[model samples]
Target chain A: MFGRKGKKGNYAYTVARVKAKKSQLMGDDAYQKMLMMSLPEISRFISETGYSKEITSMTGKFTGINLIEHATYANMASVFTSILDSATGELKDTLAADLERWDIWNLKIILRGKSFGIDLDSIREDLVPAGVLDAEDLEKLMSLDVDDDIIANYGRMTGVSIPQSVVAEYKAQGNLAPIEDFLDKHHFERLLATIDSRSRPTRLYQEFIRKIIDTINLETILKLKLEGIHGEPVMKYIISGGKDIDKKLATQLANAETIAEAENDLAQLDMYEFIKDALGKDTHSLKDIVAGLRRYKMKEASTFSHLYPLSIIPIIDYMLHKENEVNNIRIVARGIDAGLDKEIIKGLLVI
Target chain B: MAADLGMIMIGAGIAVGLTGLGAGLAEKDVGAAAVGAITEDVGLFGKAMVLMVLPETIVIFGLVIAILGVFVLPNM
Candidate 1:
């Protein structure tokens, strides 16, 4: 128990504000309404909600689903930044570290953009500045010519160690997968490293991250197996530090003859009961599994927040809930724009 | 009689002080969570206020005992 002594900031006030925002997050009913509307109508519906300011500001320049997508990303960044500003002490550190995933994401985006020779303006448009990097830092990164030296410089500037070998491998293979894998691995390894299992809240946080790692590893294995790839190559992509599945089990799961067999192997693990339904149907794709994992994580966070209301769990849960809402809305809007059917688009949503 | 009066006064002081401490401790978490709930929905102001003060009952009880000790019990 981290005793409530010398703990800076007023979590009560922050938590209260977060809860207020959480309650206002759009529900299934709103999504249903948005699903039927045209792209412009979808944008209008969003303007009436929390996203009104961003939508209004961008309306002149961008329109349709593109405007909605950019607005959603921008709003997410602002909301997260506000949360970071409100937090202090351990909570702030935890949130900052957790949010650093966005930095990794942005780095990946930049790398991918460079790989494909995409222009700076397009790359800049795709960025979601929800991490430690402020807009100015992102602007600087975007302005720099995409190459190994600039990438290394970006890493040094951000204090994120992008291993030279990953860049070398990217150069050798002329592919982004190696670099992406390295970044993903680096992020998770660093994330798991920060979590101290001694404290209850942190231990819960550790479990949350571990579950995520496990899910990522499982999805990787399933995807690789489906592609008729297996053995050591599959093992290379599997992230460590999972709670239910260890390295050996992951390797075995990866080597399994089929997806169903892999799911069967997972069924023997502790988290089988929770993830079984997601893996039950043969028709279930990697997207379904990933969505199931997100749902499970959210459910676990909600339970933890209920059990420990005053701690960091509730705040983290609220953050995840906000992210999910934005993502779901984006998916619906984009799906509608692409002329996808209602049910199909609905399936794409995590909510 | 002087010593007896001093002892009764000390007991009254202890009653109020300790119970007030207990009440403060109890209200700390409740008040925090109540404030949070209220912020989420302004309509919950009334409900949160009620919940926030519920722990004060302990201090009130303590005050009652202290008063009893100082006045009625001293005579008894």
Candidate 2:
């Protein structure tokens, strides 16, 4: 699969295929249609569309809204599998490793949800299958009791993932906080590891990851302020991989009386435009940062598409785009079921 | 003087032939991409086909050089 002919030109073929797939993703028209359906109707709709096979197989075992939920996971897993299956280089393996963020997410969700005695099926449905964890493995994970499974999984993921101390923190606090922080930290770190050193293409990818980390930290800060947390305690929660957020700066931002001041402080970076967009004048929504990450990654992928025609970048780009597409579809489907406005649902979509 | 012309003609042929290799290099990706696009959406097939063949222009230029037999013209 590593085979690729030397092109005076870079990976245009892979880029072209990725571009074609991106174009096939559901746009506003479908998003609008999706907002009008009930959960059962959504399942039927997905059954008729690209996600049909997923919906059909799951329908008999689980029905109604849960069908849409499980089928969403199935579609996400299938898409990730397709991308990994299609990938062709050393870069392919690296990209796949980065996508393992899903495992961390799944483990946390299972541990925290079960700890609170939430039903397995409901917790299972909330997972976004954008990572390397298979549906069977996820089922195995979901079946286990919360805290033990978390520690055991931490040991399993230790060499390539977060260490045991973090899991110990989870056990100690009995809260998902530390474990979730570790997962976010590892996700960004893994993204940093995958880039080619000193290349413009990889640098752009790295920046995108960094920006996302910073955004998440900012959101955490916002959440703390809303809860009236103060001083050094809130500072401890900040993840360290963001572009400009060091320990002291993170704490200061968290302690700020107004989130707008924090936004203003972050406005001078090269990604000034994106920071501005995320902060949105007087009212900041770090949710905007999450959306910004998706957009930024798309821009980086398309920009790099002209290089390494059949290399790993296109495959990675396709995977990211596909995950985002599936998420948007689920939102639209759920929004429709919830009787939300199409325009409002559209605003909520990350696509 | 005549020998110099023969040498230059052979040199030009090699140069032009290598250009086909360059064109071939470009074609592989374009072709694969076009095919993949067609698989996803049939409507893109025609336009993708046109774009995929675009690099073949390099080969055409090389062919023109060979057909003219640059030797037929004065060495000036």
Candidate 3:
């Protein structure tokens, strides 16, 4: 919704607060302690940390992993909301676009929930309104029964254009993947378009985004490779505007008959080193590969933020770190609940 | 001699004024970030105070130049 004109932003103040908040996020030691704790014990431990307020408020309503999951979503939404509220001018615009990932996430949840006839309250619990969309907007979406009407309302509210053909395909096949892919691609495209790359810092920010898009595209290809589906299906999910891993490379990686061939193609890229170990392992899961890619993205963000502390990179870094923290806690809680081994749980964490 | 003195005074004024402006610009960013840090953690107030005053050195240097011009240059 923001225009292309660059305005003065409160980067110093916002980034400082963000960095302080980031410093308070849980570290490896906390994760280790939580991994050894029981479900209730984990809940208690989480209650003692940043999520205390969220957990205490919901204590009577939910418990165990369910409580942890919902409380994390609540905490995430409030955290993002407060940050967005505090930011001014261009910074706020960039953050809103970046956090729109969560909007896409909430949209996916609503779509999936409505399609499968899931209960409204539980789906609401799963929704993290960390994006531009607020709880009220989500409530309106939840009240709508038809997917098309919900999508239409979302477009009107957010000003995001969803092609009729994509919606028609989603309707015809009853599949949500295409819709999800389109939304994600559109979000990144919008971000790139709104950014005027004339300034050096913004140019760096754009480069950072391109790197992330590349990693995401790589992750998608690896996922499709593992699923034994290739060619057209994999190509359909490829997002445009990446630095590397364009259509040609993506096709080569996707159409490779053997994983080794795909690895050979990937080895030529700079990012391959970051993910090589994950890809080379005999027992590689898409989860492990994705975690590796995410770590690299985090690394890139940190370096960029350090290089330009006054830029938007620091805020993006803080956001990524906070999201990782939430995801890590959820993983530990859910892993314990599922009776998964401790080592396995450790493997799944991006940290 | 009086006109020369007047010019020297004007030069001194420019030195101090421009430097003061620069210092204010520098401190605007630092002070803003410092307050932001302090809000998140009260314990950081002392550190923030130190950083917030760091930019004051620029203005101090400017003041010294102005002092030199006003007190020493004329005497020289």
TM-score, one value per model: 0.91, 0.81, 0.93
**Lowest lDDT 10-residue stretch of candidate 2 chain B:** B67-76
Ranking of all predicted structures according to DockQ, beginning with the best and ending with the worst: 3, 1, 2
| Residue range A1-351, candidate 2, lDDT tens digits | 124343112334445656677777667667667777777777777777678888878878987767877887778777666655554554455556767777677777777788889997788787755566566666777777757665565546434445678767877887878867767776667667766657565665565566556656766776676566756777776767687676667866776776566666656543446546666646555566557655765665655554643555666667677777778877776777777877888887875
Comparing candidate 1 with candidate 2, which one achieves the higher lDDT?
A: 1
For model 2, residues B1-76, the per-residue Cα lDDT tens digits are 6887787688668868887898877877678678767766789988997998899899888877765667454435
Q: Which CAPRI level is candidate 2?
A: acceptable
**Model 1 TM-score on a 0 to 1 scale:** 0.91
lDDT of 1 by residue, A137-177 (tens): 87777777757766776677678866878878988998888
Better of 1 and 2 by TM-score: 1
For all candidates in order, the CA lDDT equals: 0.80, 0.68, 0.87
Off by over 4 Å in 2: A1-11, A128-130, A244-248, A260-263, A266-321, A339-347, B1-9, B70-76
Q: Model 1: runs farther than 4 Å from truth?
A: A1-5, A8-11, A119-121, A269-284, B34-40
Error (Å) of candidate 1 at residue A3 is 8.6
- The candidates' interface RMSDs, in order, read 2.0, 2.4, 0.4
Instruction: Return the top candidate by lDDT.
Output: 3
| Candidate whose DockQ is highest | 3
DockQ of 2: 0.46
